[model samples]
Target: MTPFEWILAVCIAIMAATLLSGLVLVLRTSDVLARAVLADLIFYTMICIFLTWTLTNPTSIGYEVALLAAIAGGVLPTLSMARIISRGRR
Candidate 1:
């Protein structure tokens, strides 16, 4: 395997571990806000995984999806959190 592949593998491993831990945290947390934040972490981790996978095997379709995910991933979480906080304020 190439050096780049080795590094990518290590990164993917780290991201996977992060996702797992975040999932566990989300499951264990009782607070809605805490869970929402952790869930956002989990979402980003998944996006990282998808981005990493594309590094190894590039495809035009996957590239489009990855870009879309990257953009929507940021907006959705922020909007959702804002909505959640606004509701809580009522």
Candidate 2:
């Protein structure tokens, strides 16, 4: 394998580890806030995985998808958290 492939593999490994740990945390934690944050982390990790894949393969489509995923990853959870907090106050 080339050096770039090795670097990509390492990145993939790190993203996998992060995803697994985040999943474990999400499962073990009862706190809504903690779970939400972990979920967000997992989302970003997934994006990073996509970006790495795109970089190694040279695909515009993958980059576009990654961008969309990144935006959703940040925005949807934030909107959900806002709704949760607002409702909790009622």
Candidate 3:
């Protein structure tokens, strides 16, 4: 295998490890806010994984989808949190 492939493999491995650790944190945490933040972390990590895979494969569509997912994933949760917080005050 070439050095570039080896580096890609290492990056994928690190992303997988991060995903697993984030999942564990989400599962073990009891606080709702903490879980929400962890969920956001997981979303970002998945985006990173997707981008990394696309980088290695060099696909235009995959990169576009990853970018869209990253943007939406960040916004939706934040808006939901704001709604929930606002409702609590009413």
Query: What's the TM-score of every candidate structure?
Result: 0.89, 0.83, 0.79
What's the ranking of the predictions by lDDT, best on top?
1, 2, 3
- Residue pairs whose backbone atoms clash in candidate 1: none
Q: List, residue by residue over 23-78, the lDDT tens digit for candidate 2.
A: 99999999888887787888889888888877778875886697688688777888
Residue 68 CA error for candidate 1 (Å)?
A: 1.4
Error of 1 at 11 (Å): 0.4
Top lDDT prediction, candidate number? 1
Candidate 2, overall lDDT? 0.84
Which window of 10 residues has the lowest lDDT sum in candidate 2? 81-90
User: lDDT per residue, candidate 3, 1-90, as tens digits?
Assistant: 788878988998998898899899999989877777788888888887877777668885996787689679868988877766576564
Residue 37 lDDT, candidate 3, scale 0-100: 77
Candidate 1: worst-modelled 10 consecutive residues by lDDT: 81-90
lDDT of 2 at 61: 88
Per-candidate Cα lDDT values, in order, are 0.88, 0.84, 0.81
**Residue-pair clashes per candidate, as listed?**
0, 0, 0
Please state every model's RMSD to the true fold in angstroms: 1.6, 1.9, 2.2
Q: Candidate 1, overall lDDT? A: 0.88
